[model samples]
Target: MTILLALDDTDSLESRGTGRLARAVADAIAKHYPIWGVTRHQLYVHPSIPYTSHNSCAVIHIDADGGEPLNTALSIAEKTMLDDFVEGSDPGLAGATLDQVAPAVIAFGRDAQQMVLTQERARTLAANLGIWLKGLGGTQDGVIGAMAGLGLAATRNDGRFLQKGTIRSLTGPTPAELLLGAGVDEIMTLDGRRVTEGTIILKEGKAAKACPINGRVVLFVDEQDGKLVAVKRN
Candidate 1:
């Protein structure tokens, strides 16, 4: 089962951010189900928005088998946000089974990136889709961005990984298969063209990013130092 667990707010300027808490949720659930790591989606950061800092939300993907229940993960997120979030933070948690997410909810994500969204609209869409939405403290305004984050992430071509598990730095031309084994989904150029799985492409001692592009976590590379070295997408 593929799940998108998104969170927003959940922090103060002087405290730990929501991304940390989102990873904590993924770590806790890893004991039972396999975690695909968490992707960070930058929400609308405008003068009209009241954000602690960078207005980014996170969605951790979990591919579960018949073994563990999904509630186990949601419980971890709820308790962690309630306990670890800074005082006065309005932490919102939104969860969706991607296969079941509606078109409206997905559209909500695109809207959020372009303009300010209301908590009321977010709640209505979550209710219609039967998504799990909750707020921990403060005004609960975070519910808007929380659901929006999940929606945007479901686009499958929107953001970069906020925290992928044990991503080691590359020293030279590692095999493309090796990079895929480390959680990358594709090898591509800046133009989104696929690169063949041969020794010609090397990692070249750079940090690789698993960008969500066309429903895949693609590794983008460019010509650096006369060789194609792996690069990250912003």
Candidate 2:
């Protein structure tokens, strides 16, 4: 089973973003479970939403064969967040097995992309779905995005990878085979051209930013100056 551990609103403007915190949490959990990837889920951006920057949430995808209880993973994530908790940040956390995510949860994620959502609604839906969700601080409004992040990630079609294998350690031009070995499932051009043998050139100092396509980590590239350059498509 695939497990989705989600976090949101864990940082104020003065502190690191939630995506970084999610990576820290993933690193802590990596001691026990195999991390599939860390994904950044974008939420609705509006005047009403009090976000540190782009109003995005983070999720750590895990393979459930680690033999650890769900609470163990949750406790690790919770401790990681609290260890670097920023004052005035409204942090929310949620976890659910891929199979337990219902249609309503996905709809809620879709809705969050276009409209405002409430904590009560998020909490109620999580309870009904048997998803573990909690607020760490402040308004606890993070519960909304935390649950939404899980729902979006459960779809296996939204968000970009904030952490995927050793993709972050690579820079400059890299072989397609190397990227695949580093947890990239497929390497293709933005126009759907699949590449298997050629090198995917990275733009200067940029690292590979992969997106989930059809439940696989797909790295999209575009031909620029006669070289295939990786594109950030979030």
Among these predicted structures, which one has the highest lDDT?
Answer: 2
TM-score, per-candidate, Cα-based: 0.84, 0.95
Candidate 2, residue 163: Cα displacement in angstroms equals 1.0
- CA lDDT, every model vs. true structure: 0.77, 0.88
**Tens-digit lDDT string for candidate 2 (1-234):** 888899996468876889889999999998988888999999999898888768999999998742355678899998888777788899999988888889999999999999998988998898887889999888888899999998899988998999998999888989888999988999888788998878888766767989998889999999998888898887
TM-score, candidate 2, is 0.95
Superposed model 1: Cα runs more than 4 Å off: 65-68, 168-178, 191-207
Clashing residue pair totals per candidate (backbone < 3 A): 0, 0
Error of 2 at 120 (Å): 1.1
**Total clashes for model 1:** 0
> Tens-digit lDDT track for model 1 on 1-234?
688788986467766887777878878878877887688887888888778777888888888632235677788888877778677788899887887577788788888888988889999888877788998788898898899888888888788876665554544667776776776777787766677665324455535666787766777888666666777565
Tell me how candidate 1 scores on lDDT. Answer: 0.77
